[model samples]
Target: MTTVVGIDPSLTAAGVSTIKHPRIAGNPNKPICATMGRQGSNADTITQTAIRIGDQTRRIWGSLPSSVQLVVIESPGRPNPNAPGRFAERATVYYRIVEQLALRRIPVVTVASKTVKKWATGSGDASKAEMVAAMRELWPAALIRNDNEADALALATMGAMQLGWLEPELPCHISPNVSWPKGVVRV
Candidate 1:
């Protein structure tokens, strides 16, 4: 089976999740949820963002499964004046990941922030804690470590639903909720 990757891209903690084979010889072969990320304070300088972008990109790239066919990433957040460089940092990681995957012809789909929230928790403005809680309720098997992972899990589950490998069972339409690639559809 192919892998569906979900990413909540960020320079600080880039949440990456994959719905692949199974966990620990999963006899029934039911796919499992796996998540990973590195959380740290935002960079303070241009040089810092530059350095961390490479590191974040590497981590994301390493986390991807061998047969990644679809990637669902949350749209980049608007720039925050307080952070100053937040927009550049985020947009860079988003572009690099897409660019890398594009080279291999992997289709990447982006979902709006509010759409991710609403689809996952029935509210477009759900809080980070709320997202985590809702995801845990949906897939308790996953060790949801943070909000980023929760968002990424939601995004991945959405992609999995698109491919029919997994179903979130939520009361939401995948195609209507997210902008699908050319001809992909839920099975």
Candidate 2:
């Protein structure tokens, strides 16, 4: 079975999720979700930030199953003025993840933020609150604690839909309200 992993990269709280579907590969079961980030107020210097990002990336890479065939990550966009160095830090982390996955021969897919938002909430410009609400409504069982998890779920669902692994049970012409089975393993 092939598994798809979706990641929302961040130095503070990077969200990681995995969905396994043998049918997608014409085969059974597969699993995984979690947040990756270093916690420390003393991480002030550039080196410290880099180390933190590396640690987070390593954690995420280590957590992925060997069956992971595809990794979809939220592509980095313009820098956030409230968070200086965020763009560079996230870009480095993203590159590190891609490099590690490349070494393992696992393909990586970078989904645009707008794409995820549109897929999850039917609006490319949906706000964080909208995303959270949409995900909660779609998968009431999962505990979507914050926007990061919601985004991660959206990213995973987008990848699944793109791969034709997650066809919405509901009938729709364009993007439908899709949902995956519950109990996705988390670490």
Indicate which candidate wins on lDDT: 1
lDDT of 2 by residue, 1-187 (tens): 3778888988788888777764653323333457767664655787777778878888878878887756778888778898757788888888898889878877677777887787777778999999889877766656777888888876776666656766654332145333323322121
Q: What lDDT does candidate 2 reach at residue 18?
A: 76
Q: TM-scores for all candidates?
A: 0.86, 0.79
Clashes of each: 0, 0
Give the alpha-carbon lDDT of every model: 0.78, 0.72
Score residue 59 of candidate 2 by CA lDDT.
86
lDDT of 1 by residue, 74-97 (tens): 888788888666787788989999
Candidate 1 overall lDDT versus native = 0.78
Global Cα lDDT for candidate 2: 0.72
